[model samples]
Target chain A: MIIDQNKIDETIKIIKANGGHGIQKCVQCGACSAICPGVKAGFPLLCRALIKDLLNGLLEENIENSSSWGCQACNRCTEVCPQGVRPQEVVFAFRRYQANELAFSTSAVTSQMNLYETGHAVFTDPKEARRKVGLPEETPTSAFNEAAQQEIRTLMDNSPMGELGLF
Target chain B: MEQIGLYLGCNIPLKNPDIEQSFRKIFPALDVQPVDLEGAGCCPAWGTAPSFDLNTWCAISSRNITIAEEKNVDIMTGCNSCFGVLSEAKHFLETPATRTAVNNSLAKINREYKGTSDIYHVAHVLHKKIGLTKIRENLKYKLDGLKIAVQTGCHTLWPSDVYKVKEDNPYFPTMLKELCEVTGATVCHYSRLEGCCGMGGMRSTDAEKSLKLFKEKLLSIKEETNADMIVTTCSSCFMQFDMSQPILKGRGVIDFEPIPTFYYTQLLALAMGFDPQQVACISQIDRNPIIAEIQSDTRRIKEGM
Candidate 1:
């Protein structure tokens, strides 16, 4: 596969801007892949391969690969990287790039909607549960407070995720 | 007594209020006051805002932290993912450029990110503020002779630099083990102690793959230790083990008897003599066996005294 230098430069720039400063420092020692849960779970590509692809601008071809979405972000990759590559940050950077430039998965979309609608990603009615536990029907969360929920809506509306139509 | 804002995140209050109750019950006993950070939204969740944009992540998380800052207290959470996103957001906002960008978004809601407060996982507060000796002295029912498998969860230990309180050895954390041991439970160590519970984004992304990862850890715990109960400091991990295990068992993915899971705070609340029905009752897996063990031990201790 031919490497696109422009794509590599663009990806690298975004990564560096997003606190992935150590991404360029990655030595491709495979330490991250060795401990990656995604790799261990039979994902063909992982932190090491992803970093190599990101640097080589080879990620465009493999953009739809489930491995990127499967990352648990466990940070074992970051913890073991000898060069301070912080591969997890790189994974998140790539994911952000994927969501904005490529396409995000359905689950990500649902989560964003959940956050936008209810101020929570996994909200359920807690009145019964709280009553069962002998606590007040409503705790100090956005579940019952309309004003706080409005604040979350405003924050989401003003942010990049909002611009992307994610929320 | 130092007071801290209790950031419940989303999952615990909605999906697992028992975990919330446990924190409420345990905090007062330890001389730590858990003030409610009212009108707090989600930590915005890592898989959601964080995966989309850094500034959005920071803005939403900073809004939650700002609630604690308003009350002049540090924020603490029982959810590891909450700690992960909030602490990492705080770390990003520490940089002047990121802080400026995030605060600009917060300004839309008439809020600002001061970056004044610290974020803590519940275990960190217990280990750092309550102290192991104090925890031991206050136990109403010691967990003597009970074997427990400890799941530290990935978020609590990872990116250790951003975290205010961390495991002494990030890879091989002893704080959760020490806290469990203080209640007289024998902390069982399994090979996959640091493994992910497949709880967060992974489960949302791919359920089968997530369960496979969880099954590997479960089999490891059963193979390596005779742990009577699984104790974790993270609410998501508690749901993964306590809630998901049965579904996996029903699907024939796992063959062993399901091990009940407890948040460490729930165990602490139980050991402090709170009724199991109130603080520990909402689990999918029955806690009767462990509760029986605890009750028998308490009876023996009282009779001997």
Candidate 2:
């Protein structure tokens, strides 16, 4: 990506306006990315790299490729960063940007969409959550005529039962 | 004739029944009447609201508050996440413009919150309203020799500048310690006293982060304090420390004695001479030693022959 001084300046200006501090305090150390639980889970993202890209005007609105949903929002880096930069908050801000500005969605939205289609998030209400945990059949929904979607709902609800069943 | 609205959230009715049971057992002695609010759902912690989505959070939180206001009592929560959400709404409504915005948003839900109710964590009810001094008078048992490490959970302490008190010092592990002291237990000091538990951030969706945080905290508890057990007032924190800690140990991230996690009420009840069974024994995450220890102590005391 070609570096654009104007774009970098604009991004910095906007982020700072939104209460993001420590932009200039980054010393190129990768501690924020290293300590991030997201990167540990196969997300090719690093805070230092993002900062460098932002400084070089190569920042993209879509961060879906960067393990954005992988963030646990733990703020460990914010606590441990020597430069006092809050990369955790930055990642959150990026998520906001993606959701609000870039219009990117997360995998979590699939379950939410499934819920919107059905009265309950899962196909089977199971009446009691405990029954749902025990792998009961999902309550059939007239919303989506697909039996597979209903089964998916049942399976999702039953997934937590692994703990109940000692799996 | 003190009254408080009960916001049970979802866990008590479905998954964890003992919390509500314990609350009912203990509240009457302290003059607290917990009224039930029907039609309440999850607070949606991070689901319905972003950090800046204060308006949505207020509407959801206010629905419960409105229910409490109808009963004309302060709102008391059995779940820590519910307490945090309701408290945040209450805190936001304390401001005029924010109150107006929240009330305006609730028009969709056909509810208007007047900001009349006070939301409190169960710990606040027991430690603040009931006052430990008075609770101490009811003790049927004494945990005089037990060493406890109080795990003050994240949401309870975060935004510490606003939510936390100097006396409690979430950053220093004092409030929980003080509560334990009322029951006559020695508090073990440990590092990371003010840190967030990894469980708070949708750890249900992502387990590794929760596991990492739990592992680190378990190691800290073992290395820093010679505590016989770890206790917390938050249900999620209890679940993480008690349940996730063992999973992490199984993963071999840390090797230490799996300290049992107890709810603040359970600890208080145990010290007050309620049998561990009455405190709801088997549901605990790391259940082995604490129950055994209490059982052996009770047996020893009974067999005076």
Reference A-B contact fraction recovered by candidate 2: 0.04
lDDT by residue (tens digit), candidate 2, A29-101: 8887776655554455546666666566554644454344555554546656788777755655554444444
| Residue B238 lDDT in candidate 1 | 89
**In candidate 1, which residue ranges exceed 4 Å CA deviation?**
A17-19, B297-305
Looking at model 1, give its docking quality level: medium
For each candidate in turn, the TM-score is 0.96, 0.71
Cα displacement (Å) at residue A49, model 1: 0.9
Chain A TM-score, structure 2: 0.60
Top candidate on DockQ is 1
Off by over 4 Å in 2: A1-62, A65-93, A100-107, A110-167, B51-53, B94-98, B164-168, B202-206, B275-278, B282-289, B295-305
lDDT of each model, Cα atoms only?
0.85, 0.59
In model 1, the Cα lDDT at residue B108 comes to: 80
Which residue pairs in candidate 2 have backbone atoms (N, alpha carbon, C) closer than 3 angstroms, thus clashing? A123-A139, A124-A138, A124-A139, B140-B272, B141-B273
